[model samples]
Target: MSSQVIENHRANAEIYSGAPICIEKSRQLLDEISMPKGLLPLDDLVEVGYNRAAGFVWLRQSKSKQHRFNRIGKTVSYDKEVTAFVENRRMKKLTGVKSKELLIWVTISEIFIDESNPDSITFASSTGISRTFPVSAFELEEDGKK
Candidate 1:
């Protein structure tokens, strides 16, 4: 992230630090934006910042982590810092996330849920390749609720 942008947002953003609350706040932000809470599933989040006016959000973790979406048998890597411009059902200009395909890892630039379909989410890579998967694949069953 650019220093100027970070400074500006920090001045106007809702900043959440510390592990426990950052985890909750991150999940809450996803819920508010119509995204699956488990979509991020970051570990040991150190900080999170959201600039609602600019739709910019960022997550900082203690270290890089990789998570596997068992439903799709795909793995995604999250850097220590992840940033994006987010809106309802969509995250654009994403940074710090990559998905492994075969032997290559591709940088995912955008993720969106199409209104017409809604049951699926599309991930577009910076390389221009895109893939769509069931939305439920990313949704988590919070607290074991049905």
Candidate 2:
């Protein structure tokens, strides 16, 4: 998808708390934001955030007096940047418990996203071929305890 589309999606998502925004609208916003004025990069001027899902792009930024000067530009390639950022964050020696928690949370989210529409039950390979259980089984157990 075009960078403009991504920018609009971000703006709408941020403004409405995750509501989908059209590419056209995002492009317009990006164009408006990216214009240079006195100095500073638009992103630096405000808190910029982005989320990418396949072809779709979502972006958000903090509102400021220099909102007009804020340029919401899309990266030509997000994967490389994202990978590098993740790696750098992971490699930071200072990150301890928080890093571990972040890794776990990211892993869980990735698993859920990748395993969309998982079957209710899953089989296990074992000598006895033990019966497998579904996620629902665990939920049921938790509910029972409650």
Candidate 3:
């Protein structure tokens, strides 16, 4: 399937801790957790996890925000470019189902840092697929033997 890419900034760092987390970490966590990775403008997707019961969650990146500057006592506006999206795909089917059914696909429409808290980020997918799943759910069979 074709994909699109979008640029975002909030997902780059922790809003509260101000700790920088790489995109790779975000991807790893999403895969390990079996969270639905949302689709982007350029065939890109983001994996996300959440625990509604405990109010715990994680995301790959933060949202973009406008930056205001004071120039000669005047306010100027700019934007931060911390997160970005691009087309990506697996080189081959990691599963052994020999059919598309074995291949799990998810679409994500938007991703942004929580407006209330910069450290917290949220990823939203237009589809209704749930994000509360264990990482084992998406694991491909080892040695191509399912």
Q: How many steric clashes does model 1 contain?
A: 0
Better of 1 and 3 by TM-score: 1
Instruction: Return the top candidate by lDDT.
Output: 1
lDDT of 2 by residue, 56-113 (tens): 3233333211212112221111111110001110111111111012233111111010
Q: Kindly report which residue pairs in candidate 1 clash with one another.
A: none
Residue range with the least summed lDDT across 10 consecutive positions in model 2: 80-89
Instruction: Provide the TM-score for each candidate, comma-separated.
Output: 0.94, 0.17, 0.21
TM-score (C-alpha, index-matched) for candidate 1 = 0.94
Local lDDT at 38 for model 2: 18
lDDT of 3 by residue, 21-128 (tens): 234444443444333232111111133332323223333223422221121121211122212232122111111111111244333333344334533333334554
List residue ranges in candidate 1 displaced over 4 A. 2-4, 143-145
Whole-model lDDT, candidate 3? 0.27
lDDT of 1 by residue, 3-121 (tens): 35567778779999999999999999999999888899896999999999999999989999999999899999999888989999999989999999999999999999999999999
The deviation in Å at residue 22 for candidate 3 is 18
| Top TM-score hit | 1
